[model samples]
Target chain A: MEIITSSKAMQERALQLKKQGYSIGFAPTMGFLHEGHLKLVTQSLQENDVSVMSIFVNPLQFGPNEDFEAYPRDVERDKKLAENAGVNILFLPERTEIYPNEPSFEINVKNRTGVLCGRSRPGHFNGVATILIKLFNIILPDHVYFGMKDAQQVAVVDSLIKDFNFPIELIPVETEREEDGLARSSRNVYLSDEERSQAPHLYKGLQKGSEAIKKGEVNPSSVIHIIENYIKTNTNGKIDYIEILSFPNLDTLEQIHGKIIIALAVKFSKARLIDNIILEIHS
Target chain B: MEIITSSKAMQERALQLKKQGYSIGFAPTMGFLHEGHLKLVTQSLQENDVSVMSIFVNPLQFGPNEDFEAYPRDVERDKKLAENAGVNILFLPERTEIYPNEPSFEINVKNRTGVLCGRSRPGHFNGVATILIKLFNIILPDHVYFGMKDAQQVAVVDSLIKDFNFPIELIPVETEREEDGLARSSRNVYLSDEERSQAPHLYKGLQKGSEAIKKGEVNPSSVIHIIENYIKTNTNGKIDYIEILSFPNLDTLEQIHGKIIIALAVKFSKARLIDNIILEIHS
Candidate 1:
């Protein structure tokens, strides 16, 4: 596998691949490869002649108070994991390379990103959209893989690609989980043992909400209340938000008509955890 | 020459050209097909194997009070002019196709766009940056051309392309002017016959500033005073802005070090006109 550190080098390599008629697939990540990241790489490899996995700990995506400094990173281990997952290229750009000076430009997706994670962390989605656009241009990937764990991110990126007419396909991979149903996240490492034990409650709460919707609950407020009450009783996790939004658009639903995404975010003593499930109404 | 009105058809044609080893050159314009736009297209034909020109009177770039509804457009005339200039494909996507809904996304450049015309028309650069990105993606040109009359716009776009790492090269064509020295623009149609006669004073003011800089005058206040006084005396035009700035960054210059751009804007009774000239100093 080829390893490149500069944007020019990556584009030159991508040009050569294009000359050979190879379809390129990209999986952009913030290093610290978990089972979740490997799943995306695996999916990318299956879809294209060449798979490129970029490990950039983007400083723009983190807020002033967020865990930018404390975010997990292990380059050697990530390289080994990506190689094993059949990635053809490992692009590890330095912070200066990704952002030469402070960025003077921004890409913002409205409405879909204004709720959920976007509410608490302002400018987060703008940062995501900006870096993603830069990466897409540098790599010229035919398809890009994103994890479903970042449901709002997927929606925002979808709208960005659509509105900008970026010539890339977006493929969303399902959330990778532990045996006990805790969603896999690099931040999960921050949890204490007791917090880890209680972390599964977030997913359990989502499952309960999905089950309630499966049982013909059409009202969004009632579903949100049930999920909120479940998390309050089962764990000491602080609720950030419990929202029942329409799938894809993420608009707040007055009545669940077609498909709805029930998303939740909770903060334990040690870490913040998020998870979601999509529900469809048959009638 | 092939004329395509749908974006999908144009992209497909561009991709086919790419596969067959053709270097794409693009010229994006708001279609009245003036001599200025033809100069850009003519340069594209000389430098590239295929030349694609897009004629889109982007509504996003016009302020609510600006002349969006009365903006001149003659498609049949534009087609003939493009063919005569040896353009290979003419892209004219409909307004609805380009803006399917109220655009939720905005691409904005900072620092550079806050002066001159941008001060009067809020959100104009945001709209320009957004539509240019869309056109760049759809056309996938090897080199894109813009007139240097919009010097601030060229600077902002140059910064954006570099910041985003777009693969296309930028070619800044010299401003095309009429015999009396008025820079050709679609908005020139808005000028009454008497107002049209006074339009050349904008260019005359730019020439006076450029000549002062050429004769070793580096004081910005002196340079601005000369141009403002010329415009104030020559025509009954309202001076919108007249400032001597560092060439590409558009920052206020304490002393002329290397390159300086002298820019001016004047509002006549019926139209707004802008012009500029770049002066390079050598040791």
Candidate 2:
């Protein structure tokens, strides 16, 4: 495995692979590799001749009050985990290298980004779209893997790829979970022991919502209310948002005829945990 | 020459060309090809194995009051001109093809865009940056060409290329002009015969400013006053802005040091015209 820090080097390596007819798969992450990220890497290795994983703690994605400083990053450990997971290249760019100066250019996905996480953390999706574009251009990956943990991010990236007509294929892997059903995330480390015990409630709430919908709860508002009630009763966590949005586009729908993403964000102490489940309902 | 109207078709063709070891040179334009645009196409033909020119009158780049609808476009004439100029592919995507719905993503370059034309036409550079990025990604060109007539645009694009690390090279072709020194533009068609005659004065004013700076006049305010005075006296033109800014970056300089770009925009009776000249002065 080759470990590269410079953007130029990564591009050169990606180009070389392209020239040699090697299909490149990329997984972009903010270090602190969890099983969730490794799942993405594992999928990339299965589908492409070369897999490149980038660990960038994008400062732009974090709001002024967000956990940019405390966001987990362990380079040596991440590199080991990535290599073991069959990643061919580990791209670790410094903050200055990723963002030389204040970024002049921003990529914003309209409408889709103004809700959910986008509402509380303004400019977050713009930052995600911008850095993802930079990563896509730099690595020139044939396939890019994103975890379903960030459901809105997946939707935004999918829209960007289609809108810009980037040749990259977006493969969204299922959310990796702990044995106790808590979604695996680096931020999960921030939860206190008691908060950790209650953290699984977020995903449990999503599952309950999905089950209710599957058992013929078609009213969007009623579904949201049930999920909100579940969170309120089961845990002390503060609900950021409990939304039943149409899958893929994330548009709010009156009736759930197709796949709907039951997504939510909850805050417990210093940790903010987000999770979702896609419900495909027949008319 | 192949004519592709769909983004998917053009990207496929571009990919095929890449696989066959042909480097692509691209000229992105809003049609009604003029001598300036032809110069860019000619350069593209010379520099790469294949030249792809796209004509998209991007709505995003136009202000609410700007002449987006009235922007000159002659597809038949443009096709003949591009074919004659040795263009390999001419991409003419319809409005629906480029903007299916309102565009969600926007690319903005700060500081560089808020001067000259950008100041007058707010969100113009954002539109330009967005479409250019889309074109660059779709065409996957080896070298992209732009005319020096849009001097601030060149700087913004140059900054974008650097900031985004797009693999394509940016080639700034010299400004192409008519015999009387009026920079060739599609918008020139909007000028009445009398307005056309007065159009050359815009260039003349730039020349006067350049000569004054060459003769050791360094204060921007005095230089701008003289240029504005020339335009006001020579033609029925309303001064939009007269700025003597640092070249490339377009920043306002207290004292002219190495190279300065003297740029101005004027509204004639029937058309808006802009011109500039870079003055390299020795200390």
Each prediction's whole-model lDDT (CA): 0.88, 0.88
List, residue by residue over B189-267, the lDDT tens digit for candidate 1: 8888888888898899888887887898878899899988888888888888887788788888788767878888888
In Å, residue B8's CA in model 1 sits off its true spot by 2.1
lDDT of 2 by residue, B83-188 (tens): 9998899999988887777777776667687789989999999889888878887899989999998999999989888888887788999999999999998889
Score every model by TM-score.
0.97, 0.97
Clashing pairs in 1: none
TM-score for chain A as predicted in candidate 2: 0.98
**What is residue B66's positional error in candidate 2, in angstroms?**
1.6
Error of 1 at A113 (Å): 1.5
Model 2 has a DockQ score of 0.66
